[model samples]
Target: MKQVPLHRLFMVLLVLLASASCREQSRVPSQAEITAISLKRGQLITCGSSDKKFGTVQFDVSCSPEAQTDFNLALSLLHSFEYDEAEKVFAGIIDENPACAMAYWGVAMANFHPLWTPPSEPELKKGVQALRIAQSIKNKSPREADYVAAIAAFYTDWEQADHYTRCGRFEKAMEALHTTYPADKEATIFYALALNAAAKPTDKQFSKQKMAGQLLAALYPNEPNHPGIIHYTIHTYDYPELAALALPAARKYAAVAPGSAHALHMPSHIFTRLGLWEEDIKSNLASVASAQCYAQEAGLKGHWDEELHGMDYLMYAYLQRGDNDRASAQLAYLQGIKKVEPQNFKVAYAFASIPARYVLENKDWQAAAQLKSRPNFPWKEFPWQQAIIHFTRLLGAVHLGNTAAATAEMQALQANHDDLLRQKDTYKASQVAVQLRASEAWIKLQAGHPQEALVLMTQAADMEDSTEKHPVTPAEVLPARELLGDMLLQLKKPQQALEAYEANLKRHPNRFNGLYGAARAAELAADGTKAAYYYQQLLRVAGAAKSVRAEINAAQNFILAHRSPQS
Candidate 1:
C-alpha cells in the first residue's frame, strides 16, 4: 500500500490532538463553577502555584506521576485549610487520571472543614458525591481506603448527627489511623488537627488543644516550613494563658506561607490574645493585601470575605492603638463592598462586627443606636452573629436614656440567644447570653434599679471571665468585664470600678477602653499615682502620635493638671 502523504498524516494527527484537548478542557470545571464550589470552602482566594511547597508531606499513593505531584500539593493545601484550592487541584488530578482515588478523597476532605463552620446542605451533597466516587474506585491501598473511610465517618448519617458529633467521629477515625501508622507523619499531623477541631471552647483546661499542641510541637523542628504545623500551633495556643507559647510559630508561619492570605492573618490571633497591637496590625495589613490580590486575580466582585476578615482585625488593632483614622479607612473600604462572595460565617462575623465595633469603641451612642446589619446578607443564618447589632443598639439606647428602645433591642438579643441554643451552638449561645445580660443590666440601671443592675452586670462579667473569647472576634465588641467597670463608675462606686477595670486589663491588656477606663476610675478614687500610670500606658498604646479620640485628650489633660510643678 502507498504510504499516506506526510502533510495529510500530520494534519490528521493535529485534528486528533485537538479532539483530545477538547475532551480534557470539557472535563475541567469552568471558572464560575469553581467559584461556586469554592464559596463553600470558607475563605477561598486564588494563589500562585509556582512554589507549592507546603512543607514536607509524604503521602504515598498509586497514580500517574503527574497526578502524584499534584496530589502532594493538594494534600499540603488541605492541611492548611486551603480547601477550595486543594479541591480544584485534586479534581484536576482526577480529570487527568480517573483512577486516582486519593484525589477524590481530597475533594471530600475539602468540603468537610472540621474546624470552621459545618458544611451546608449544598456542601454536604458535593462531599457525599465525591466520597462515593472515591469509594467506587477499588484499586485504593489499605491506607488510602482507611483515609477515605475516616472522612466517610463524618458524612455517614450526617443528617442525624450534629456537626460536633460528626467531627468527633472523624476525630476517632483519625486517632485509629494514627495508631495504625505511627510512623506516618501525615497521619500524625492530621490526627493533631482533628484533636484541635474537637476541642471545646468552654474547656478551660484546654485538654485537647494542649494534646494537639504537643503533637504539632514535636513535628515542628522536623517540619519547620509546614503551614499546618505552624498554623495549628498558633491556634492551639491562642488562649490568653497559652498565647506566649505560640509566638515562635506565629512569627514563622507568615514567612513559611507568605503567599497564603490566611497564613499571614493567623499570627495576629496570638498577637491579639497577648495584646500585641503592633504585630497584629502588621499581620493583618499584609493579609488584607494578599486577599485583595487573590480577588483581583479571580476577577470576583468586590473584596473576598478573607479580606473583610483581615480588615476587621486590622481595624480592631488600629482602634486599640487609637489609630482612629486608619480604622475609619478600613470601615470605609468595607462599606464600599456591596457584596461578599460566599457570604459565610466569616463574612457574617466581620460585617456584623466592624461597624458595631467602630461606634461602640468610640462610645458614639448615636451611631451605635443606628447600627444595622449589612443588607443583602444572610443574617438569618447567623442569629448569634446578628446579636452583635442588637447588643450594640441596646447599649446605645441605654446610654442615650432610651429605655423603651433598649428594652426592645434587649428582647431581640434574647431571641437571638435562644436561636443559637436551638441550633446547638453552645459557645455562641453563651456569647449571646452575655450580651443579653449586660444589655439588661444597663437597662436596669436606666430604670433606677441600681442594686439589681450591679448584680446583673457582675454576673455578666463573671460569666465572661469563665471562658475565652472565640477566635472569630479580635476582641469582644465590648468586653463584658469592661462594661462592668463602666457600670460601677456610673453607680459612683469609683473604687469598685477601679478594681474591675484593672481586672479587665490583666486579661485584655492595653485595650483603649480598658486603659482609659482604669485611668478615669483611679482618678475618681483619689489614686493619682495609679491614674497617671494608666494614662501614660494609654498614651503609649494609642501611639505617641496625636489622636482623634477625646478620651486620649482627657487622659492628656488629667496628666497635665496633676503634673509636678518642678520643671
Candidate 2:
C-alpha cells in the first residue's frame, strides 16, 4: 500500500507463489492414499493380482486415482511384449480419464515394440497421433512430459529415418531421461531395454548388450518379480558367452509371469542356448498353449504370432532331442496354418524356418528338395525369409548329387541375398552369404575340388562363428562348422573332421547331427574310447526318444558292441 519499489513488490509476490507451490507439492498423495481413493471408487488396485499378472511395476504419474492401477498393469504388459493387450488396457484408461497423458504414452509405446520389428506404416501413424495427443494434454507432470518426449523421439521424422536411426534416437532420449532421474526405476529399466534394442547383432564383444545386462542385473535383486528386469536380462544376455549368465532369469521369468505368452516362451532362449532341450520343450509347450488361448480370447482368425514362434522353438528342441515324432507333429501343425494374426518378421521367420529346419535337421534331402513355400504369406516383402527356402533346396540338391539343381537353387539364393544387401539389411545379408558359401563349397566338393571346397567351407564356418544368431532363429538352419566337419569326413580326413565337429559341439552342444558327426568322426579316426564316449553321450541324450533316425541306431549299435561282457 505504501509507495514501495514496484520490482521489489513483484519479487515478493513470486516468493509467496513459490512457497504456496511447495506446500502443494508436500501434500502429494502416497500409494496408500491413492489406494484409499481408488477403493472409494470401488477399484481394487494391487500389483501381482490375477488381473495384472505380468509383474510388479510402480510408475507414479499424475493421473486419476482409478487410472493408476490400470496404467501400471498396461506398463507391465508392455514389458512382457504383450503389445496388443497393453494397448487395450491403455485405451481403457484413456476412456475412463480423458486427461490421463501417461495412458497415451503407453499407447504410443505399445505401437512401437522396440525389441520387435519396426512398426508398420499404420502403426507409426497411430503412435505419432497418440504422442501428439499426450503432448496436447497439459495435466501431465514434468516427469510424465519427459516420458512422452522420450517415445516422441521414436516417432519424430519416422518416414525420413531408417529403423536403426529411429531406435538410436529413442535410445539416446531414454538415456537422457535416465540420467536426469537416476533414482527412477522405470527410467532405468526402460533405458536398459533401449540399450539392448540398439545393440548390434554382429558386435563380437557384445558391448551394448553386456552393458544392458549389467544394468538389469543390478536391478534384479530389488525387483525380482519385475517383468521388464528379468525379461530384458534374458534378452541382453541372449548370446553364447552371456547365455549362462541369464540362466537364473530364464529359469525364473516363466514362473514369474506364466500368464504372459512371451514370458512363457522367453526362458527357452537360454535353455536353447545351453542345450537344455527338455526345459526348452517345456517352456515352449506352455507358451504355445498360452498363445493359443490368447488368440481364442482375442477372436483372431488364425494362430497368434507368438504361437508360431513357440512352435518353431518346440520343433527345434524336439529335433535336438531326437523326438522326431513330436517334431513331425509340429511341422504338421505349422503346415496347416495358412496365416498368422500378426504377420511380422518373427512370424515370417518361423513360417519359413520351421519346415526348413525339419528337413535339414532330419537330413531328409528328398523332402528338402520338395519343400514348398507356404502360400498366402507376403513373401515379396521378405526376401531374406525367401532365402530360407532356396538355401534348403540348394543343400538338398548338393546332398542328392544334382549339380544342375544345386546351381539353380544357388542362383535363386544368391538373388535373395542380393536383395537383402540392397535392402541394407547387412546382418541378414551376411547370414545369406554364409548359406551361399556353404552351399557352393558343397557343390565344389561334388565336383571333386576337395581342397577348394575345404577352403571355402572353412571360410564360411569362420564367418558364421564371428557373429551370433538373431533372436528370430534358435540356431543356423545348418551350422557351417558342422558342414565343414561333414565335408572333411567325406574327404577321408576324420581327424580334421573330428576337430571341426568338436569346435561346433562347443557352441552348439547336444545337436543330434553335431553329436552323431563327432562320434562318427572319432570312430573313423580309430579313436574307440572317444567314439564310445560320444556315442554313449548320444544314447544317454536321446535313447528314450521314439525315432528311426539312423544316427540314433548307429549310436545304439556302437554302444552295444562296445559293452563289457561281464556287465
Candidate 3:
C-alpha cells in the first residue's frame, strides 16, 4: 500500500461524497410514493367524523408524516381567511418538519391574497423568499413541486409588473393548477376566486365571474359548511344581477364561520346589493360585535379595522332605511373614536368613507363642503381615502350652485386621480376620475350649458357602466348614470331621464332614489301606468328613505287620486 498523504485522502473523500449525493438526487419520488403520504386514520385532530360538516376541509397533501395534522389545519384555516391562525399552524409545521416543502408554500401563501389587495413590496419579497426555501427541499412529490412552481411563476417578475399584470399571472397559474388537479377541490375553489378577481370592472358580461359562480355553487352540496365555499360564493354573486343566486350561501355563511368578522360581514354584501336593509343592518351589527370580540381575544385594546369596516356598512344600511338618527349617531361614534387605526387599509377606507357617506348619502351639501379629515391621519398617505372626502366636496360644490367652487374641487379630484395613476392603482384611478367627471357635468349644468352637461354626463355614465361598483363605497357612489338621470330631469328631458332611471334600477333595483326618480320621471313623461307602478314601489321602500317627504307625499297622492281601473 502506498502511504498517501492526509491532503490526498481528503480530496478522494470529497469526490466520493459528491458522487453519493448525485446518486441520491437521481432517486425521485414516484406517484406511488406521493400517494403513500396521505394522513393516517389517527393522524388528524379528530373533529368528529365529518370535518366537512364542521366547516373544515381536510385535503390530503404529500408532506412529512410528522406535519400531516398541522398541514391539514393550516390549509383549512387558510381557505377560510383566517390568515393569522393559519400562519401560526404553518410555522409550527415548518419548524417541526423542515423537509415539508408545502409548509413553506403555505407560509408563502399566507403572505398573499389572490382577490384582495396585492402583497406590499416587503410581503412579495417574503413570499418569494419562502418559496425559494421550499424549492430547496428535496424529495418533494411532482404535485407538490407543481404547486410551488405555479406560485413561483406568479411572482416571477412581480417587482417589474403592475399589480393587474401580476394578478393576471397569478390567475393564469391558478388556472393551470386546477387543470392539473381538477379533483383537488381546494385548487378548484382557489382558482374560481382567481377567475372572479382577474376581471376588470369593465367586464360587464361577468363572463369570468359567472364561471366562478358556477364553480363555487357546485361545491355547496358536498361542502355545505365550507367557509370558503360560502364566503367566496357571496363575493362571486355580490352584484345586482347575481345576488339572488347567492342568497342561500349568504344566509348560511355567517353561521358557518360565526367567529370570523369578515364572514359575519360578508353576507351583507348581497344583502346590501339587493336593498335588504334589515338584513344588512343585522349582519353588520353582528360583524361589529365579532370584530371587537376577535380583537379582544387577540390582545388588542382598540378595535380592529374590521370593526370600522362593519360600522361603515352598518351606517349605510341605517341611512338606506331612513334610520337617520341612528346613522347620525353612528357618525358621531365614528368621529369620536379615541383613536383610529388608519394604517390598516380597511380602517383607512372606512375612516374616510363613513363621514363622506353620512354627508353625501343624506345630500347635506353644506356639511360636506365644511367636512375635514377628523382623524388627522395622513390623507396624502392614503390617496383613495383622500379621494372619498374630495368626492363629497365636489358633489356638494356642484349641487350648491357654485361652479367656481365645484371646478376647484374637481381639480382636487384630478390630483387624486393622477396620484392614483402614478401609484399604479388603476381601478381607483378610473373610479375617482369618473367621480370627477360626474361633478364636472353637474357644474356645466349649473353654468347653463345644458347640452355640454348632457354630453359630459353621458360620457360619465358610459364609463361607469363599464364596471361593477366597488364594495368599498356606499352602493350609490359609483353610478354616475344616476347623476345623468338627475341632470336629464333638470333639463326637463323626462323620457330620457326615465330611461336613465330605469337603467339605474336595473343595476341597483328597488333603491329608494332610483325608484323615486323613475316615478317622478314617468309622471313628467306622462306615462301614468309606469309612474303609478314605480310610485308604489317607491312608497314600499320609502320607510327607509330620508329627505323625500315631499316626494313620498306626492307619490301617495298620485297613487290614491289615480286608482287603477281594475281597483
Best by lDDT: 2
Per-residue C-alpha lDDT of model 2 across residues 1-567, encoded as one tens digit per residue = 779899999999999998877665444333342222111122222222245467788998888888888888888888998777787788777667756778878878998888777788888887887777678676668998999999999899988888888889889999999999998999989999999888877787988888888888888889889999999999988887888999999999987876688898999999998889889998998889888877776667988888988898899999988888999888988888876887788888988999999999988999998889988788878888889999998888888989999999999989988898887888889999998889889999999899999999999999999888878778888899999999999999999999999999888888888989999999999999989988887877786676678888899899889889997
In terms of TM-score, the best-performing candidate is 2
Clash number for each model: 0, 0, 2
TM-score comparison, 1 vs 2, better candidate: 2
Higher-scoring candidate on lDDT, 1 or 3: 1
- Candidate 1 on 300-388: residue-level lDDT in tens? 78678888888888888888988888888888888888876777899999998999989999999999998877887778889988999
Relative to the true structure, candidate 1 reaches a TM of 0.89
Q: Could you estimate the TM-score for every candidate?
A: 0.89, 0.90, 0.87
The positional error of residue 494 in candidate 3, measured at the CA in angstroms, is 2.4
Error of 1 at 198 (Å): 0.7
